[model samples]
Target chain A: MAKKPRKKAPKPTPKETAAKAKKPKHPDMEIPFLKNVLVLIALFFLTYYLVGNVKGYKWLQERFIEGNLNKLEKFADLTTDQKYQAYFRFNHQFLTFIRDNTADTAIIYMPPDSVLDVEDKKSAFYTKKRSNSVQHKTWSTYHIYPRKLVYDREKEEIPSFDQYTHVACVDGWGYEYLEYDVPKQQRARYQVLPRTVKGLKAMNEREKNQAQ
Target chain B: MTLIHLIVLFLCGFGLMNLISPKFGLLEKIGFSFPLAHGLVTLLMLPYDLLGIPITLTSLYIPQLLVIAFVGGWLFYKQQLPQAVRIQDWNKAKSFGFLSINLPWIFLMSILGYLLYVVIAKAMFWPTISFDSVAGYDFVGKMIAIEGKVNGSMFDPDLPFYSIRSGYPLYVPGGFGYAYLMGFDSSKITTVLLILSTVVMYYALLLNYVKHTMAALFTTLFITTTEYIAMSALSLSNVPHTFLAVAAVVTIFIWMDKRDHRYFWLGVIFMALNVWARSDGIVFIAGTGLSLLLFAYQEKKWKELIIFGAVSGAAFMIWQVYLSGTLGITNDGVFVDHLFWDGEKFDRMTDLIWRVITNTQFYGVAMIVIPIGILANFRTIHKQHYHLLIAILVSWLAYTALYYQMDNGGENFGYSLKSMINSSYKRGMFAIIGVLYFYVGISPMTQKLSQLIIEPGNPFKPKQ
Candidate 1:
């Protein structure tokens, strides 16, 4: 008996053929250039808006910082670069210092005005008190986000500043309800800030001049 | 003599009780060890009441030792006790044993080992006060002991602002509340009873899942290895209830399989015990009852279904009555008083799910085995294991949802989520795990392997 012929697969319909043919050579190109540009703009503005306004992201960042600080071990071995980076990163400079120095005694400078906000409310320093335009000022003042450092463990601590009482500033971010070790002896009773790099530079300069 | 001496004396007393226990019938044998341990510990504390020993390490150690001695003796006696019913050594038990019982045992061992290292060597108990235990089991346990009844206050303090109505007693296998009610100091009894109940719970869980005695023992070993389970057992909260929940699930599933109404009653007893172990148990009771009805439906046993329905209904109604009449609580606040309606509650619940999904460690290491098992028998899933797995997953989902939304308007989602699982979701998922294991252990594939080797060529072979 003759073997039954296998049925040939149906040919593609014109619509299917056209659809397949019409597929973009670079598939992503069909996304309009203008739309792409708009998206980029939107994302930029969106990130800016969210970062500036939403309290949730800020809270998460703070928690992330707290978590990171708690995880840090052996601060004495940090690179000078790492020390500066960490110093610039967290709101809790004192904790960063403790983590770095493993200090037997180290001072944390808390401005008398640095009362911790224990209540689950937005820091007054950020909200309510500031004008919309000026809120960014307060936001910039605190290291509001956690920065994951990729520093060698051995190169974490370096004495960069001559004002080395081996102190770390642990910014409570106004949540004093959270606990960390900060000895009374190590605390700076006064917080002096024009809090700018320039201001710090000026203070260093003044100290140098006085020493001279 | 110091408190240590008193504890040593208590240890001797407990050993004595265990020896005498075997003679006085089953209940007496089962229960006798508890009294000597609890009584001695209670007496040791009396000096604090009478002579006022400083409430320090030595003082706490005294009671802790007394309790441990009792449990140790109980364990010793259990080892000596003959296997309850020597089932003819069907190789079926051996084959299914590893997944059901051995895996839990191994898991428990590794966990306990790590925890010991961390706690003893590193002096680390990070994120202490086990999260889930504080909210559901531990706090409520204290309340039960203090008030001598399950009350609004049992769910209060944990979620003071929220008015929830889902309060049930501890649902863990080694039910803390049951032990507490059986006349152990709520605070002092927790460590001892939890450890003891954990062993019993594991054996029971294994019995339902594994067919072979060795396999059951192996599973118990796995449970002991699990750090989370070990940590949980020691805490005042979730571990005990989680164990109980698993025990209840295993017991009922066994009842279904065995068609033994005695197992059914045992299941009910465990379920009722679970109710007092944790607030989430109320929802569990409802879900479990629904699942049992499905089981009855599958078996075409209307009589069993009706009986189960009535018993489940009576159990729930009793708790409801207690809540409404005795405790003066509303439906929303009987068990856990989490803020359910609030947005924050929803967000936190979502966040918790996200965290669990994201965290690799949260799902125990043995999780890898489960997928492999499923993959190996993917074809059988729809025909055999689907319902069981589905029931367990659904129960977990339901319990999580209840806990996620238990607070007041989700206002305190952080608090609510934390309260529900308390520390971790491990304890909350205990019952579901037990259900999953029963399916895993009793899978046709596993059971068939055993039957093939043990009772080969027997005419009355179970059909696949």
Candidate 2:
């Protein structure tokens, strides 16, 4: 009984150990084609949902397709000036009238902001709350360029006030600067009148009479 | 005639790009052509006006042609002309059933195409009707075209009719003036072309980072920036400036990632043009320049840094010189020269920025998606994309600080601090949105996701 003993096993070689160490413990796992497809589908839906939630669909349909594409034909035949007219409406019309009536070299005396701010049915040139578009020197000058505009507020600062050859009469406020009398039928709510010598003379006479 | 002018301009840009570097993708060349050409043409107008030369179509066109011929001849002589369009990747993907397998690309493309069509149609159909355009850029542009000079009668001392915005920069006005000189009935064609070119370049640039589906998805997101797209239809400098500034920042980042000299030079040119587009674009220049300084110092590329600084700052300096030295127009204290601190203004600005950025109506889901992507990849932020993130943060901080230090107390166009924060500051966020989306597209999370969708094997599988 004492002589019965088990034998010890031999150790593996270095090469064998190295080969075993190089071998992978687990095989590579291939993702199923269906799983990949599902992931793709999920991503697509997620993106679509996010985009939709952000109003992309509504914007495409309403702002672009309906708002622009549908009106493309209607706006196609319109000339540049006509398109401006459509957008700016009465403000553009008034500016265009000034541009047409005044000479390129004419120095224009622009009406005060008060004249344009008048909201009464008779005296109001712009009935909308957006007043003083015509009275804005920069905006008016943009429409009628090469023609000088002198504002009442800045007339003293601008030495060209004395060189004004025309007056923009808004709601009959600038008629005092005009040399000629206007008939009631011929008078417009907005008109540009030439400041001739006779008008200056009449203005001087009125000033003299007021002084006396 | 419009088509002809555009073609000539494209060739000019193509040639210029070729001169910069012969190695370029076809899409890159085409996408970059118009912006580069337009920038050069507009820049030349300043010198032309200074020298009393009429800025006629002939003056601009002839110089552009010479440039094209020189570039074309040089490339041909060097045998560096592109032999063929390399679309083999697309064909290979198609052959491997990639498109059929990944069907979302179709949806994304469809959305992008539809949006582009509508946006272009809107821009082309409308005349210049925006208050800013009518009173400022368009007005000055029309006068420039008529008088063949920037210092025309409109700038006469006796007639102070031009708006404050007229003195900002001449790029937008020059674009409109170029269109007018080309015999177009409306100058809105400039805006239409800018939108088209920007979209093309944006999508093309995105492709370098992400797969087709991801690129298209982000591009769609970019185009659908609610306020940006709505404003793109009208002629305003904001959208165009957004394009230039975004292009500059993204290209600079691309250079940093790829280490390509060509991209570095391209980034420089675009950065310069960014300032040329709008002076406020200097904020972007500063942001990108600081990043480049770090890059150059680390890489020992002092020469590249010098070139970038010189070229990028050239336009801003020239513009300042022209305004103060030549035109005799001094700043009427619009910008504060020194930096100062204001706790109330700082708090208010931060609050407005947070409100605007979080508002889905302004930027769509861009604000939402960007933060999520960034936080999801928080572990890799320092190692992977800290440079870009820093640039964006620095640029935004500078922009906010610039607005904060301003003397915005006057009645210049009814712009109050709140309105400025709401409108202009909001619009400037377009550049930030664009860059952040680009960052997300290139982030590790997105790249891994892209791999999972494109590759057939399990991304989670252990390596053998």
Candidate 3:
């Protein structure tokens, strides 16, 4: 049998041609104004999601860290290394403790970490000027004088502390103590900080002399 | 702060750039939009030394005074400021029945802009928290700001730390000091503006090639969400450097693809200036140049090849001359790459690779999508694309290799790995983000995948 006459496709209407011309190559690109709006709305939600992630990051930092960035809680119980990390954040608290409790004549020894590779006290001074920070140090440094002699602790570098009646360790990290040397053989050591003249007779006498 | 000093200075600079190079008609295409304004600002800032005076409050403020006087004179003589500066392209487009990104859309853009402002401002106020910023980058910047010149004490030999940072490129610090001279003494302001300019410039750049949506998406994703850029908000470390790197790559590609001389000169300048942005920027610039040379060779563009090679080679020499001559920073010799065989080199390398590819902070799902997207659209890639791909790979790999040559090996292998993970990984990631976006943009499957997720039931969708 002869092949049936092939049917011709109908020509597209003008409206159809316009629609075809306007059609996007990718479906996602269609209704571009709408797509842009939707993508942006999704972005808003995505930002919130990222913010949540930042919160988790902050939380992780807290769990692994101690001291001020760790909420400045009592870190007397943490290990030395843990306390070292805590000291990295608690320099502010250390300054506060020194200003509040210790004698202005008291000198502090702050041991710098070799890992940080800081050369000397001047290094932190230049680095921390913008923040008005105490020598770019939250770990340990000679930047926390406030009204006391804060020395870089290298044993030989420290001056004789015999002239000062009181010694306070305000690093807020490991080995925290404030002690007043008594006239006699005995020494008065405080188990806790912010300790006033309840037990030490010599400290009370020194305070009275200062006030007078 | 009048804020208008900043306004007038930047506007004058923008006008000046347009006057200098009318091609691309930056102001015409984008108007006073973010990208155009940013490019003009960057051009002014990059060669800011041409101002040829000590950067002091008086010096910077005086220049603004001069520009304002000039603009004021022009306004009186011409009876108008040009429409380009008076209005942004977005404000003058015929989209959605009115000019440019209209209505609630503008409101939406405002919200986004405000959020970025808040972030940038916070970073500005925050103290230099990162080691690199504190020890080297900002330290150099603050000294220059204080002294009103590039002080050589930044190269102090007593401190080993200064030695490490002494070789750091000074253009960024110079930019910061210029802002400081303008009495804005905030590194945050300088760094944030640099970042905003970079983002805007890159966006303007892509608009020259891609569709508007693709360009928009790429800018939004690549610029806004990159973790390192966010991490760098408080410092001028990587973001500033990355700007020049991306500009170098993008401009070269634009030149090769479009055969535009504007792009060629622009890319060459970017390459030369990239060295001034960061020491490692040469890796990106050189990689792009190598790719371009290969491209030129294949296309048999002999004169173009000679010109490109000569310009780039001279630029490198000029950079060295400026460094040793004007800056007085002598290289301490080749870095003892002893850490090449140090602990966990292989392991650290692997971790870095992981961080670059899988880090959700910057690329989001892009890492997963890009490779699969490429595989799905493998046939779509042309010869020209292969050349671009080589450029991208070289830039990314060159840095990864340099990571091995560093002395970052800490106490143990894990410590070494952590060190690599900390900063080096971010640097490498910055190199690839733009390139990966381009690849994904060209990939056919990336579009289909987006359609599948974002618009699942379009009537225009073809049946399987």
Candidate 4:
């Protein structure tokens, strides 16, 4: 067929193959009003999402941690070193957990009974009975207070956010309110943190008065 | 790793990202820097055996990181690219337009941030670090350290803990927390976080500067660089608060310029979130919203006026609803609480703002306001852009007046104003600065600079 007129294909109609590319006509096409409305809607939902799902964001891993105290309870005849090792592990993990969760913004609270040795009458944790209703606990020895966030409007002044905690022990010495910043990460390992009130020997009459 | 080692790694990562990037714009720029920040954060993990490096953690794997980088880079690039490459002339653009404007300060800020990390991180072994850092960010960090998640109430239960007020926000916390999660000590991470944040703001403002987006970014940075902003960031929660506040302002300004109104929505959402970021952000959003409404009305932009009114009104209402419904609290209680125990010391604070306006006894205290006035006066030279300068001046003055009025008849009102200025001076200054920056870009001076300072075919052209 003589190559069908040099194999010239049928031309595509305007609707079939392609139409000429048309100009946008308006330079303000980039400034779409609807896109803004859509963006606004998206922003609204995002704010809602962040604000709404806060509870779900809470990490409940701490409650599930296995304390060495539990292991000691199970194995009553454990060695002192074994018990100490477990206590150390439990405390380390607990501290680590707190640091991880709060971004190093947390509080530390120690019970009145835990301030000093239970057997010694002159222990650092010892507290004098002020009256029937009120008693005095020597709280100055163990200074690692719990960190609480407080609101401060003065930007240059103290932090608005603060840490608040009530430390109570097995003994009936009552609860003590403690507040302090999160401990430094580097020193967290080297420093003993006065695990017991007896560990600190710096408290005096003046300091005792100041604590009250 | 040593600081030098970290620096080397950062350079390597930055180089790798730049090589991988398809082109230069928003994502590419961020791509170049994001890896460095991320790598630094991960490298911090080398000290801790339990935590190990973050890259080793399953949650922070390379693939997931790449995905995050891709998404973050893409979105930021998308938003920034439109503003960056859209410029007509590449030569007319300054050398590293985004880099130059911010690099000067960011480098300085990084050094300062590093020094702060070292001083606080190491010295914390002493008992003195106990009172501030321990009770402040360190305590918050400890909570996260133990919990492996962030919680607001841990910092201070007395404050509004329900919102995002207590801890660092998403990007900020991620930058800092990533270090700890990866096993690096927190002190170093804190330094990295501050540096990264400053850089983020630097680039963010640079992008704004490039497209004639806003003036507040430059002014805000200028104000932040002052002793007041520096002191505040060193002391309290305002560092993150300033960032969040600035973000909200940028969104609002973009909305105003483009009138796409989507930015308004973003602004409102950010404003609402800002309140939760820090107690003062609510005030900033409210003040800026009022300014926006007034400006729109003045400009005869009826549509924008309505949008600003509705969005701003709804934001306040939602916060009120949240306070009332969730805590059964009122603004009066919140204000009273702030007054007594929140460390405002109101009278001294207000004095700072008053002195700046009237040029009172405290000359240096108000020195920061000079650049703003100059920026405003320069804008008046061009009749078309005059109203923007006027609006910024009026809004800033109005805020000062409102602050004064609120403190009126109270003891030491001047002090309260001083306190407000001290805390908010940087951000307030920024809002004006960003607008004025846009003014400068359109002014004759900018054209002269483009001819002299910028190269040929510069992309930064004055908008007609």
Native contact recovery (fnat) for each candidate is: 0.00, 0.36, 0.01, 0.03
lDDT of 3 by residue, A112-199 (tens): 3431223345432223323323334321222232233332343353335223333342223213233433342233222112222443
Pitting candidate 2 against candidate 3, the one with the higher lDDT is 2
Compare the candidates by lDDT and give the number of the best one: 2
| Predicted complexes: DockQ each | 0.01, 0.18, 0.05, 0.03
Q: Name the lDDT value of residue B227 in candidate 4.
A: 33
lDDT tens digits by residue: candidate 3, B271-315:
655666676776776677678878878788777667766765665
Say which prediction, candidate 1 or candidate 4, comes out ahead on lDDT: 1
lDDT of 4 by residue, B112-179 (tens): 45434433432221221222233344444443444444432343334332222223222333334454
Cα error, residue B388 of model 1, in Å, equals 3.0
DockQ of 4: 0.03
Question: Mind giving the per-residue lDDT tens digits that candidate 2 earns over A95-192?
Answer: 78878766688788877777766355564355453422666677777777778789877867976668888888876678776666767777777777
Clash pairs detected, candidate 3 = B124-B188
User: Any runs in candidate 3 off by more than 4 Å, and if so which?
Assistant: A1-212, B25-53, B60-91, B94-118, B156-163, B224-226, B302-334, B337-344, B410-417, B442-464
- How far off is each candidate at the interface, as Cα RMSD in Å? 25.9, 7.3, 10.6, 21.5
- Categorize the docking of model 4: incorrect
lDDT by residue for model 1 over A17-127, one digit each (tens)? 999975543321123334334444554575356435544333323432233334444454565335434433322342233334322222222222234222224543222
All-Cα superposition RMSD per candidate? 22.4, 11.4, 12.2, 18.8
The superposed Cα distance between candidate 3 and the true structure at residue A62, in angstroms, equals 15
